[model samples]
Target: MTEEKGSMLQSVIHPTAIIDPQAKIGPNVKIGPYAVIGPNVTIGEGTEIMSHVTIDGWTTIGEYCRFFPCASIGSEPQDLKFTGEKSFVIIGDRSIFREYVTVSRATGEGEETRIGNDCLFQASTHIAHNCIVGNNVIMSNCAGLAGHVIVEDRVVIGGIAGVHQFVKLGRNCMIGGLAKVVQDIPPFVIADGQPARCVGLNSVGLSRAGVSEEVRRELKKAFRLLYRSGLNLRQAIAEMEQELDSSEEVEHFLRFLRNADRGICRGTKE
Candidate 1:
């Protein structure tokens, strides 16, 4: 057990719980039976760690979060070369880690694994180390993240999807269940299949989200250049640059495509 020195440690711990005296627990927090809070753990105000859960080292969780039964957070990265570096898991407020969800600590020394606010991780989901997860994301049951993946805001990942390491899923993207996501998924699209392909734009989603019609038209045109024109990527991007004026949404899409380390999912099969 490490030393705890903070305004935390003022929280309520169940009598049945085994929290290290060294762990820093915040105000109005609850710890359930047989829950083990290891050293260097800092749980924020109004959070709850349920029964049989284990929160390990160097973990920092924000306020109003909930961890269900058997959820394991801040465990060491599963990467083979990890020699117990001082990696951290930083979680923001109002997030839910459901039953059996496991979020590993960072893989690089002194590096941080980050999860933004209002995200939901359903049962048995695994977020590997060094992953950057943005706000309002929902990952369904049995969805797993490999090391260093980046998931942008407002994305909904379907059940049992396996995201490849370093793959990035752009904002507002939807992936179908059981898909093997080996490439990057750009923003505002629906991707599905064994090897994922961009099936169509997420029109219904955008409509429900209250996106403007003009923006939708711009996105539609952009999509046409990228997916429907049959032009190669460079040619398509060049054409889009020539034809479409810069808008925030278009710029985001272009930047996503430009910065793709793992290539974007194609509209058609090879």
Candidate 2:
């Protein structure tokens, strides 16, 4: 391999660690004791793999990422339909995987389990097969996303929360601890309780994200129409179009609602 596309020998690889010669290791990377890196893996520059971490499969980790002890990445999907197909796990830059975190590769050939940049995955978090996790997301300890789940940017999933397969957690939303999310969570809202109902807008999260108060007020109107009003989804959307003002946030909120094939989480349980 040429200098631009070659493995640079680590300055600090523990003797107990076993990394394949064919594996592509970037410059300044550190491998701790007992870590196992497979040949198919490509770790980017300056990444750190702690003790006992196992990285395998067709995985591409981004630059400056850190994997804590016992973190297992790029294992094949747990799906019953996976048949040894060639799939991939692509993680973006600056992500941190805490202890015992497991991120599985996709199930189908040529598919991918993709994670975006700057994400924080806490201990014991499980990202199932074919999941698409967007940037700046945070998954608390023990939170698990089932196969094919799509977590949009800046979402916060609380500890022990379990998201059902194929459910989409919209951008900037927050799922409460111990919540069971079975439906789609709309953007910029807080969802909680069993089966997960929309409690309110994630006002604090939006504020921290630097959302303007004017835009937030528009979102509050959208929330009221969607959750507080006695209207069905169609009615709520129609009301939103007629009464509420337009902004990027409001448009995104409307677009998420329009794609609620799995159905959005309700404000209350029947």
Candidate 3:
């Protein structure tokens, strides 16, 4: 080992911690007892790994991230087709993983599971292989995301919710507790129940995100056209383009609706 690899700063790591010599640990990082850091792991400045946490594989963790006890990150994928191919898990800054949260690496070679900044994953949350999670997202306790899910910014996933693989959740959307999400959820919506049906707009979420009243009203109009007008997807898009005033928010909504590959979630009564 080179002198740099052999001379890791040991002040913050507990005596029982086992960090590979090749692991790159930045300044002010704190590692607690019995934590295992793999050779290919890179932890950024001010990150904290608590007791019994295991960070393995080719993982890159950003600055100020915190992992509570028993959290496991960058583990091999659980897919049956995994054949020991190299993959990665990349996380952004200031995220928190609560006790027993697990983030798995992607299945294909050179692929990665990526998470954005300022996300909070509560206890026992599971992010399966190849998921892409956006910034400021919140996953309540026991929420589980299947492989290949795409979660956009500022979304809230309630406790015990289970998202199906390949589903896309749009920005600022909210999913209620125990929801079983099987399809795409459009932007700024609220969905709940088994099989996850859309119920209403996420007014509170939009307000918290500093969306203006004018934009919110336009969004409401768009929502009515999409859900209550009894129009199909293409027809609703046409109506929105023709009737609703142009705004960045409304245009994003139309684009999301247009690109809903797995199909958008249906209305509650539909």
TM-score of each: 0.94, 0.96, 0.96
Clash statistics: count for each candidate? 0, 0, 0
Stretches of model 3 off by over 4 angstroms after superposition: 1-7
Where is model 3 poorest over a 10-residue stretch in terms of lDDT?
1-10
Q: C-alpha displacement of 11 in model 2, angstroms?
A: 4.3
Candidate 3 per-residue lDDT, tens place, 79-120, comes to: 998899999999999999999999999999999999999999
Pitting candidate 1 against candidate 2, the one with the higher TM-score is 2
Q: Judged by lDDT, which candidate is best?
A: 3
In the range 75-160, model 1's lDDT, one tens digit per residue, is 98899989988989999999999999999999878998899999999999999999999999999999999999999989999999
Instruction: Quantify all predictions' global Cα lDDT against the true fold.
Output: 0.89, 0.93, 0.94
Per-residue lDDT tens digits for candidate 2, residues 1-270, read: 112224565446777899898888889788888999999999898898999999999999999999999999999899999999999999999999999999999999899999999999999999999999999999999999999999999999999999999999999999999999999999999999997899999999999999999999999999998988889999999999998889888899999999987998999732
Q: List the residue pairs that clash in candidate 1.
A: none
